[model samples]
Target: MRILVCGAGGQVGHEVVNRAPGFGLVALGRNRQQLDVSSPEQIAREIQEQRPGLIINAAAYTHVDNAETHAEQAYAVNRDGAANLAAAACQAGIPLLHLSTDYVFAGDARAAYRESDHTAPTGVYGASKLAGEQAIAARQPAHLILRTSWVYGVHGHNFVKTMLRLGRQRDALGVVSDQIGCPTQAGSIAGVLLELASRYARQGTLEWGLYHYSGQPSCSWYDFAGEIFRQAHELGLIERLPQLSPILTAQYPTPARRPAWSVLDCSRFEAAFGLAPRDWHADLGEVLVELSRLERRPLEAGVRRA
Candidate 1:
């Protein structure tokens, strides 16, 4: 069966295309140039022509800080674009797997947020994503909203890549320690999506609702950066490590207000799919190896697995 993956050029989308074939499925990936979700006509035409067994909507305006200024652009892609896909999926009578974010919550909760938790987004990016969730829920009956956080992968730009880049350039770096969330890997999310796609492609139905899947042992961004450098050094990717300074969120201000506590409860997803939680730190090591290979730098002996 053919599975249509939007945002094929993105981190998760790229992983989905790479992993889909392993599930005995044909993956049809459409980047922005091939499919613009904001335009319903374009979406409808592509869906009609491709006639995919399932649709995975991974497209979104993910620039958290830039969304503060480009509210319209963010909404056009995240909210309206999502609605268009949901509507088209409804017409096609197929299941839609839409990826979401943890920013949908207000970020003030003391505990991890559940799927049933009330949403109160702090920034335009979160608000737009929340609107997209609402649109998909309202338009499609067969849909799965997979909300993930702090997603990083070898295929695209993310926090891990950012830390590696900055660490190489500077002797000391400061990262926010106040905000804490689960760091997820794009490959893990892709695996779940492909599993769900394979199931839906065969059965044509599922529970159809929102779910969460993130890496285990949530930590602050500061901790995450420290772990990245440690793994890089252990992998022999770097000779010298920079001093990582933990600072308050206010020390590094952005246009968007990130969630202070955005870790998600993944029990619902685990119960339904039976997919085990992934270790982000362990996955980070594998990612470093993949990235090193991509950069044409081979790792030294005695490299540690993530």
Candidate 2:
């Protein structure tokens, strides 16, 4: 079956497109020109052109700090854009699977969050994504929304990449330790999406309306960054292991507030698909290997600055 993938160049989107062929898929993105999802007309036109049996929307306005100022843009893309895409997919008589985040929770639970938990987002980004979930559910019936947390991949500007880049420049670094969440690999999430697609092509509708997915272990940002640097040091990629000083969320303030506990329970996904993601650190090694290989290529000779 032909599936259309939006947000095709993002961390998850990049992984999904590269591996989509495993599920007999045809992917499409905004191209370099940038497809604006706020416009329903553009979505309709694209749906007519691609004629995909399924639509996986990985596109989103993901700048957390920027969303505090540009909330209108975030809502337009995350909420309204999802609605537009779902409407288009429903018109085409197909299933729409969208990716969401764990930010929908208040993070006050002090433990892993289940699918049945209540949502009280503290930031514009989370609220906007939750709105997107609601919009899709309201607009269409054949939909599967997967909410994940602490997503990182080989390609995008993610937490792991930032730690490696900034960690080398500093003699020591400060990371927030109080907050906890899962460190999901983009490749694992991509694999999960493909598995869902296979089931959609087979049984057509899943039992759950929403599901949570990520790697096996969950930890704080400080631990996650520390591991990234540790692995980099092991690979001899860096000169030294920068001292990681753990701090609290209040110590490292940002415009957008993150949940103190953003961890998601993946029981629903595992039970439904019988799939479990790999360890976060194991996936980190793969990324480093890929980055190292890319560093040696002549085409990317000068691109490996960090």
Candidate 3:
């Protein structure tokens, strides 16, 4: 079966495009330049031309802080774009798989949030994403909205890459210790999505709805940074582990308000799909190894000396 992957340039999208073949899928990936989800006509044209069995909308306005000032653009992409895709999918008689975030919740809950939990987003980014989810649900019944958190990978700009760069430049670093969520790997997310696509291809149906899929063993940003440095240093990706300082959210203020607790309950998804979330620590190690390999390529090509 052929699957259309929007946002092919993104971390998760890149992984999906590369790994789809292994799942017996022909992936037609389109970046923002090739396919702008905000435009209904463009989406319709592409869908008509591609004639894909499944459509995965991975494109999103992901800049949290930037979304505070640029709510219009955020809504344009997150909300309107999603609605456009859902309408097009409904028209094409194809299922739509969309990627959402954990920010839909206000983060005041004492325990992990379930899918049925009330959504009260605290920022523009989250609000826009929640609107997108609602739009998808209203427009198409054959849709899957997977909400994940704290995604990182080797292919794109993310917390892991930021930490690696900062670890090399600074002797000491401060990370917010209050905010907590699962550190999901982009590859893990891509794998799960492809698995769903494969299952859909075989069964021609799915229990489509909102589901929470994230990494195992949640931790704070400080803890995540510590693990990054530890693994990177062990793999020779970094020369020294920087001193990481745990700080409050107030210490690192930004335009957008972050969730104090972003943990999600993914039991519904597991029970429905029979696929458990992968261990984040194991995923982290795999990412670090890939980063290490990328770092070595320049030296191997004689672009940088030992």
Candidate 4:
């Protein structure tokens, strides 16, 4: 099947693009002057050029804090851009796999947020993403809107890479601990999208609904940071173990507010597709092992698996 992958350089986009050999893939990004999603005409043009059987949209204004200050840009890219893509996909008679966020929730729920959970965005980024979600839902009859949380991968800036970098520079670090969420790897999400898309191709049904996609187990930001650093420390890349002091959300002030509980329940996705969600720690270890190879170093003393 032919597929069009937008935001081809972001974490999720990069993973999708890298795994595109299974499908005929047309990848585009902002850096490529040929592709500008902000313009509806351009989006329509690209869709026509690719004429893909599926469109996977991974593009969005993702800087949570920055979105607070640049609400217009965020709205234009996340809301209007999504609308443009959905309209173009509808015109082309194709299903779209749109990646959304869990920030749409208000974060007060004691249980994991399900696909049917009520959305109450607490900040500009969340609000903008929610708008994009609604736009896709309004127009596409056979779209897969995957709402994921705490996504990280080998590509792009994410908590994992950031922690690794800081772990090397500073002797100790203060990571926020109160915020609990899942640490989903982008590669895993890409694989799931492929599986779902192939299944749809065979059955020819979009199913037309939202689903939560995340790692099986959940954790706090501090827990994620500690895991990342623990793997890094094991790699012998850093001289000393950085202090991972857990702090509250307020201690780490930001322009945008994040949901205290961003964990997404993946039971619906699993039941629909009959695929199992992966353990985040397992993927985390794999990523760190790859990092060690990239760094050309041996595993350090007392190094635990990622």
Candidates 1 and 2, the one with greater TM-score: 1
> What TM-score, computed on C-alpha atoms, does each candidate reach?
0.96, 0.94, 0.98, 0.92
> Which lDDT tens digits does candidate 1 get at residues 138-252?
9998999999999999988999999888887889999999998999999989999999998887787887899999998899999999999999888766777999888998888
Those runs of model 2 whose alpha carbons end farther than 4 Å from true positions after fitting are 31-34, 299-306
- Give one digit per residue, the lDDT tens place, for model 3 in 1-306: 999999999999999999999999999999999999999999999988989999998999999999999999999999999999999999999999999999999999979999999999999999999999999999999999999999999899999999998998999999999999999999999999999999999999999999999998889999999999999999987899888899999998899999999998989999999989888999999999998888888988889644
lDDT by residue for model 2 (75-174), tens? 9989999999888888888889899999999999966789899999999999999999999999888899999988887888998888878877898999
Candidate 3: worst-modelled 10 consecutive residues by lDDT: 297-306
Q: CA lDDT of 114 in candidate 3?
A: 98
Model 1 error, position 189 (Å): 0.4
Q: Evaluate residue 84 in candidate 1 and report its C-alpha lDDT on the 0 to 100 scale.
A: 95
TM-score ranking, best first:
3, 1, 2, 4
Q: Give all candidates' CA lDDT scores.
A: 0.91, 0.85, 0.95, 0.83
Please state the error at residue 69 of candidate 4 in Å. Answer: 1.3
- Residues 11-83 of candidate 4 have per-residue lDDT tens digits of 8888887776664443433322556667988888777776778888888889999998899999988898888
Alpha-carbon RMSD, each predicted model: 3.6, 1.9, 1.1, 4.2
Counting clashing residue pairs in each candidate, in order, gives 1, 0, 0, 1
Question: What lDDT would candidate 2 get against the real structure?
Answer: 0.85
Question: Can you give the lDDT of residue 168 in candidate 2?
Answer: 71
Clashes of 4: 1
Candidate number of the best TM-score? 3
